[model samples]
Target: MSGQNAVREFTAQMSVREGRWRLYVALLNTTEQWPEHRFGHSVPTFMDRTDALSVLGFAPVPGAEWEWTEDSETPDDPASPVVLIAAIRVCSWSGVSV
Candidate 1:
């Protein structure tokens, strides 16, 4: 197995605390070998797409190469089981294609 992966579909929520914005990573897609994995991380909001990659164990990919296919304000946090978000697309750190 190699030291990289990809996320075919990525979904995340937004959060704010102490006057700072952050990404509240919630859901993640997984490869055929595994089920979709849920994640939680309070990462500072970054205009760079690849910022959350390494933190999730991904090797490396250009942050700019990633294009946001979906993004919308989410209010389900306080109402449901949600928290900070930091997600990746097309891959998982376990060498699985998401």
Candidate 2:
């Protein structure tokens, strides 16, 4: 349970607000271990992928890698097995961890 290896999973969504793409993200707490977990935040639109990562607090550098795996299920449907409108993994940078 070392903090260094801890991976934070998040479910992200992109929507147009004020005619610009914005990012909303929620922490995926599978274990329910943290009762204080909160809902996602509405982040402002970013200039680029690097800017997006920086806004999300992942100081992404050159060669930094991440992905947005599509989730076929509808996020509004509770019965859906997956809710990944966009899935992102917070991995160590230097920048090649998934």
Candidate 3:
């Protein structure tokens, strides 16, 4: 695929806000593929990151994880660790076989 038909790149990130973990996804370069979602608008937030990933049709690769030190609100607090998935794959449209 090339140009308009090409699959765009997307990056996912997670951060803690108000004691709750939130998942964020970079907007797709082309909205033509996902007309249901609007451009330059706020996306909805899900309490569970797994749920958000499901709705977005993405899954993390097995054994790929990393610590997000930038999101550590209290670096001095050893009790709180910011571990996040480092790699992910776009699942099939049917939401099966990642």
Candidate 4:
């Protein structure tokens, strides 16, 4: 696979520290292969850092922002089953972090 394609297959995982948030991106590969699969991406944003931390079972840290990507694969037909590639977390105060 090309380097760009490899990066796309990777997911970003984020965690919060005392007053800062850390991000970790990882590559993921699937054993199963399917044709004509649809892919999608999304980010989770929170207004308050506390709220974001709460869901992560961590205490609210300073300069915390809520952000994450929701990536998945869906079938073209409504009745078709859906597949989730991976959940990517993008932590940033203003916009999504790479």
- Give Cα distance to truth, residue 61, candidate 4, Å: 28
Off by over 4 Å in 1: 1-8, 28-49, 58-90, 95-98
Name the candidate, 3 or 4, with the larger lDDT value. 3
For every model shown, what is its TM-score relative to the native structure? 0.30, 0.35, 0.41, 0.24
lDDT of each: 0.39, 0.40, 0.43, 0.34
Worst 10 residues of 4 by lDDT: 32-41
CA deviation > 4 Å runs, candidate 4: 1-8, 28-98
Alpha carbon lDDT at 98, candidate 3? 12
Superposition TM-score, candidate 1 onto the true structure: 0.30
Per-residue lDDT for 55-84 in model 2, tens only?
A: 554443344344545453556776765433
Q: What is the alpha-carbon lDDT for the whole of candidate 4? A: 0.34
**Model 1 C-alpha lDDT per residue in residues 47-71, reported as the tens digit of each score:** 3334544454443333524233332
Q: Say which prediction, candidate 2 or candidate 4, comes out ahead on TM-score.
A: 2
Residue 5 in model 2: shift from native, Å?
A: 4.6
- How many residue pairs clash in each candidate at the backbone level? 14, 0, 0, 1
Residue-level lDDT tens digits of model 4 in 11-91: 344543333444333423544221111112333244333344333333323443334443324435666443323233332
C-alpha lDDT of candidate 3 relative to the true structure: 0.43
> Residue 48 CA error for candidate 3 (Å)?
5.5
